[model samples]
Target: MVMEFPLLEGLSPVERREFIAACTPRRFRRRDIVCHEGDPGDCVHLITGGRLVVRVTTPLGHTATLTILGPGDMFGEQALLSPDARRTATIVAVTDATTLTLNRSQLERLRLQHPQVERFLTTSLAAQVRRLSASVLEALYLPVETRVLRRLAHLARVYADGAGTPALINLTQEDLASMAGTTRATANKVLRELEDQGVVRLSRGAVTVLDPAWLATRAR
Candidate 1:
């Protein structure tokens, strides 16, 4: 079956077909490490199902989650630009997941055949850079509560299933804390406050965003 990707939006039918044909599908169980930081980057993955987290570790052994990604998101694109590029962050499966991967060689060949492919990759990389920059700025200036709210809002937006249902973030408080660069205790406190305000409903291992718009406003 042919899978559609947002990154391939501008490609012609033939180009899309060729790109899909070149891709190899891979699956991972929950908690599986897709790639580790500092490892040789070999392929770019476009998530086809479930969710994953992008995390980084400091030299001092501290680890933090940079972001959560779901279907339609792509990762490991840096490899396509440089042969010696290494993974900048670790990617781990948040749930049982599947992805369509394109190796460096296949992507290089496709870029020569279709200039738009290169443009797509460049655009994706730029977006990633902008996101990282924003995260740095937030960490430097925002208070812990605001940072937590912003991170929760981001997850809600990414994982929202259309059909008018509320967005449910299937993650533990510890995971949310890591993503927000806070302690689990602090995250739990903020979540309880949000729950009292009717912004979210917290259950074991999950948070249901009841008022995403309100939460986003508070995040700002």
Candidate 2:
């Protein structure tokens, strides 16, 4: 999991080992609520296994999926960087998951010993901003089918299992709708069209991408 993280990329072998040794490993079961929105940000989590869904709910109970994070991704950094920061989103385990954590106390030590962590936080925060900006643009002008297809392609590219398993996105129609900024019924209709075109297959609580090439074209 540390292999691809830019923060650790510049470290020497000895330094990398020492940095990893400082982390505390934590595990969560499937369906676990790893952290709740508005909770005190006490730890930064680096994902080592499984997947997580970042979600937010408004006061009126309207929920949306902000993003789906897979292994090698990290979260809670924003909280760790700012004093008195509360979690901006709730994170739930999509499968049994493992993350290495650094509490605020330990982070202080890391700050002094390994300054590269600051670069990681800054880079990650910037990427999040760019993604949110693109999301706003998509919401403003993209049509429903185009948005749905694009969301699927994005997930497949980011979260595809490198193992021999199918490059399928294991999310429900409702979750897809939430991520695509569309209604569930509209998502269903568009998915059925894609299904007819042999682009995807709909199963219980999941949608399997059949032709990513074609789906990518629709996204364009």
Best by lDDT: 1
Tens digits of per-residue lDDT, candidate 1, 1-220, equal: 3444676766777888888888999999999999999999998898888899989997789887778998888888888778898999999998899999998889878888877776667677778789789989988999999999999999998788866589989888998998888999999999999999898999999999999889888888
Give per-residue lDDT, candidate 1, residue 49: 86
Q: What lDDT does candidate 1 reach at residue 91?
A: 94
Distance from true location, Cα of 96 in model 1, Å: 1.4
Positional deviation of residue 77's Cα in model 1 after best superposition, in angstroms: 0.7
In model 1, the runs with Cα more than 4 Å from the true position are 1-6, 10-14
Q: Clash pairs of candidate 2?
A: none
State each model's CA lDDT, in order. Answer: 0.87, 0.81
- Which pairs of residues collide in model 1? none
lDDT of 1 at 109: 88
